[model samples]
Target chain A: MGVPFTPRANIIMTICLGTIACVVTSGCLLWFAWPYSDYERHVGWTVEQPVPFSHQHHVAGLGLDCRFCHSSVERSAQASLPPTFTCMTCHSQIWTNAAVLAAVRDSLLRNTPMTWQRVTNVPDYVYFNHSIHVVKGVGCESCHGNIAAMPLTYKAKTLTMQFCVNCHRDPGPNLRPAENIFDTDWHRGPDTPGPAALMALYHLGRRNLTECSICHR
Target chain B: MRCAWPLHVLPGALLLLAAGCDDMSKQHKENPYASPRSAPADVAQGSVEYHDTFHPAPGLTPALLQRGRSEYQAFCAPCHARTGQGDGMVVQRGFPAPLPLATAPTRSATPEQLYAIITSGQGVMYGFAQRIMPDDRWAIVAYLYALRRSQQATLADMTPAQRAIQP
Candidate 1:
C-alpha cells in the first residue's frame, strides 16, 4: 500500500495518537484494576514475607504435598494458614542454616506464628471452600496452577468472577478424580469425558453444582 | 484517524456483547454472605428465629459462668453496663441504653427468645449474631444466666470457689 495524498493526514494522525493512548491506558487498567488470586486482590501488589520458602524445592524436588502445608484445603473455609509447627516438621532437620528457618524455629519456640504475607488471598466478603472444590473433583491447578514448579509462587491465574463462572459453566477440562485432584499428572483419563459429556452431565445433576449460598454464607 | 474508528468503536461493541452472554445467573461469586439456597439447611430454611430478651442458662457450671461473665464484661459491658441495668459507660456518657433483659416477661422470654434477640436485634439493642459466632453467643447467654443467678444466690449458700470471685 502507498501513502494517500495528504488531504486529511492531521485528522488521521490525531485519531491514531488518541487510539494508541486509549489502548495503552486500557491495557494498564486491566493490569492494575483487575483483581487476581482467590482473594480477588491484585497479584503483583507487594506483600511482606516472614520466610522465603520455595515450592519448587518442597513440591517438585522433594515431592511434598500441597495439603501438607495448606492442610485445610480439604477441610475448611479459610485454608487454615499453617501453624509454625507445620514448618518445624521439615525444617527441624533440613535447612536450619537459613536465617529465615531460624526465625521460623524462634517463632515456634515462643508460641507465636509467622506473619507470612498471604499470596492468592481473596477479598474478606468472599467465602471460598477448598473442601468442596477438592472433594467435588476440582484440580488444585485449576486455581493454583502448577505450583510444584513455582519457587516463589505468584498468583497463577486471574481469579476474576468470569474465570470462576466459566469453569462452573463448563468444567470438563478442570475435573479429575477427587483422589488425584492434587496430583499434577492427573488429566482427562483414558475414555476421556471432555466438555460435551460434562455439559450433558450438568443437566442430570452429575455436575453436583450448587447455588450462591454454598459460598456466600 | 485510521486507528480512531476501530479503537473506540470496535472494543466497546465487543465488550458490551461479551458481558451480556457471561454468567447470566445472579450467582454472586464474590459475596461471602450470599444466601445458601444451594445447600439450604433444614433448620434455616424460610423460618426466622427471634432472640429478643437475654436469658440465663439454667445448669451452667461456675467456671463456664465465670468465663461467660468475663466475656460479657469485655463485649457486652460496653453497652449493657457492669450491673446489666442498661446503663453502661456508653449510655452514661452518650450511647442509647440497652434493654433490661433480666426482668423481661416469660411469654416474651426463653433461651430461643434470647438467642433471637442476640441474632436479630431489638429496638435499640442490635443483634450480636453476626458479630459473634454461634458458640460464643451461647457462651454469652450462659454468662447472662450466671449474672442473674448471682443476684439471687445468698452469701450463705455461696461456694468457696464462687466466693473467691468477688469482682
Candidate 2:
C-alpha cells in the first residue's frame, strides 16, 4: 500500500464502522418489534374460504344485522355460524342456478354442513364470551374492526394479549349505549359521556376486570 | 476491500423471505356474499303468459309458520313492524310509511295476491323476491295471516289456556 496506514487511524476507522453497524442493527430491531408491523394485522392478508363471503355486501349493501347470521352472539360463548338452512333461506329462491352457489346447494341436498374457515381465533387458555361483551355495551366493531367495509373477511385485530389487556384496563372509550351495541361505526361525540363515565355507567369498574379467572376460567 | 458476497446475498435472502411469507391460496375473486345482478325481467304484465297465476304454496305446517315468523322478524321487521303496523324503525327514520298489513283491505286479500305484491314492487316498496325464498314467502304469508288473526281475535276466540294466561 502507498504509505502504510497508521495503527491509530486504522483503530479510529474500525470504531466508526462498528458504531454505524450497532446503530443500524438496533434501529432495525426496534422497527421489527413494533406491534402493528406484524404481517397478520396488515391488509392484503386474507384466509382462503370455501365460499367467499363478503361482509361488505351483506352488512353494508343489504343492511343485515350482525345477529341475523351470528344469532348466538347475544347469548352464547361462540358467535355461531349460520346453519345451512339460513343460506337456503335466500339462496333457495335467488341465484338457484348460479354455478358459484353449487357448494351451498350440494350441502343442502347432501344434508352436510358447510364449514366456514374461522378467521379470528384465541388461545385455548383464554375464555372469551361473546354474549357478555355484546350485552355490556361493547360494539361489534370494537374488536372486529371495520367488518362492514371488508369485502372478504380477515382478522382485523392482532388479538395479542397486550391488545386484550389494553381494553380490559380501560373500556370507556369503546363503550356505547345498549341500543348502539350493533352500530360498528359509532363514534363518541363532544356531548357524549367520556370513557371513565361510561365505565361507571356500565358497571364495568370492577377492580378484577383484569384478573386471570375473569378470562381464563 | 469488502467482500461482494453479502451485498448479493442479503437482498436476495430478504426477497426470498418476503416471497415465502405470502400465501398463494387467497387469489380467487368469486364472492357468493356479494349480491349478484338480478336477471332482467323478460316479460311485462298483461302478456298472455303473465296472468296473475301465483298461488299460495301448500304445506303450511306449524313449524313453517314459526320459521316464517322468525324470518319475518329478521327480514321484514325493519321496514314492516313486527305487529304489521308499518311503523318500523325505517319509517321513523323518515322512509314513507308502508300500508299496514292489518288493514281491512290488505287482510282480505288472498295469500297469492299478497305473494305477488311481495314478489313485485308496488308503489314505493321494493320487491323482496331476490331475498326471500318461495317457501319462506309462503311461510311469511302464513305468518301474516297469524298476525292478522291475533290482532282481530275476540275474547271468545281465546282457548281456556290462553284465557288463563290473559291476565
By DockQ, the best candidate is 2
Candidate 1 residue-wise lDDT, A1-217, digit = tens = 8776575987899899999999999999877765443345554433446677777776776555566566556566655555665564445544567776887887766655566655675544456778777766678888877877777767777676667777776666777644466676556777766656644543334634446654456
Error of 1 at A147 (Å): 0.7
Give the interface-residue alpha carbon RMSD of model 2: 12.1
| Best of the candidates, lDDT | 2
For candidate 2, the docking band is incorrect
Estimate the overall C-alpha local distance difference test score of candidate 2: 0.73
User: What is the DockQ (computed on Cα atoms) for candidate 2?
Assistant: 0.04
